[model samples]
Target: MTCDEQTFTMKPGEFQALGTGEIAYVKPMTSDDLTTLFPQAPRMRPGLNLWVLLNADGTPIMLSDSRETALANAAEHQLHTVALH
Candidate 1:
């Protein structure tokens, strides 16, 4: 079978079987890492009653008073947005 065929038939966690029994070290996720992996909603400045749009890197991009606008902004920017409750 070709690589493509193998890839298509492979199931989750099956890739571990191809390992050579070598110990793989992985770093624990830091707060910054978590922030980037998940979406964040920060309150806007006082008196605006809005939310600031933040990228995965936690950088402010835009501001909107509605959650839909924030999600739309993320979609327009080709980024995935998630709600953090």
Candidate 2:
């Protein structure tokens, strides 16, 4: 799938539509990432444990919890998506 298009385990992983084709995977903000992401928070949807995952090719694969298992799965699969929630 393209970066703008995704199929996330049939689950709802929201995609933040950034202008200039800079689409970001919407995920729950971590303390560190949050500080940085917050500046852009106004553009994000509120209140969801989201983590945008991508493929090696930079296509959105899914959003997931920030757990090792979830990350491992994504890494094993070599998904190009980022885990944002």
Candidate 3:
């Protein structure tokens, strides 16, 4: 029979067919797989005296006299911020 019309029967010691039509591309994933799929969180950098918000790539994105302002700037630009020591 053709693939589309094939009938599968599993015997007592046999392994059932796994990848059929829609499930042909399905596979199990590990923790690493999920991590790779999502990607690591962006890195945040603090200015020389904790006076600025830097991008993940270490580029200065905002400069403010206070930490709150810097965090606000990051928020306004839709960026996640983390405190860097």
Best by TM-score: 1
* Model 3 weakest lDDT span, ten residues long: 19-28
The TM-scores of all predictions, comma-separated, are 0.41, 0.31, 0.39
Candidate 3, 27-82: lDDT as tens digits: 22333333233355233342223354555544445444466776666667666655
Please estimate how well model 3 matches the true structure, expressed as its whole-model Cα lDDT: 0.44
lDDT of 1 at 22: 24
Give every collision pair in model 3.
none
- Candidate 2 similarity to native, TM-score: 0.31
Please provide, for model 2 over 1-85, each residue's C-alpha lDDT reduced to its tens digit, 9 standing for 90 to 100: 6789977553223332222123223334433353243344333444545554444333444445564545665556653334343
1-85 per-residue lDDT for model 1 (tens digits):
7666643566645654433232211122333333343356342233444445564434456655566676677667666555544
Comparison by lDDT, 1 against 2, better one: 1
Which ranges in model 3 have alpha carbons more than 4 Å from their true place?
1-50
Q: lDDT: which candidate is best?
A: 1
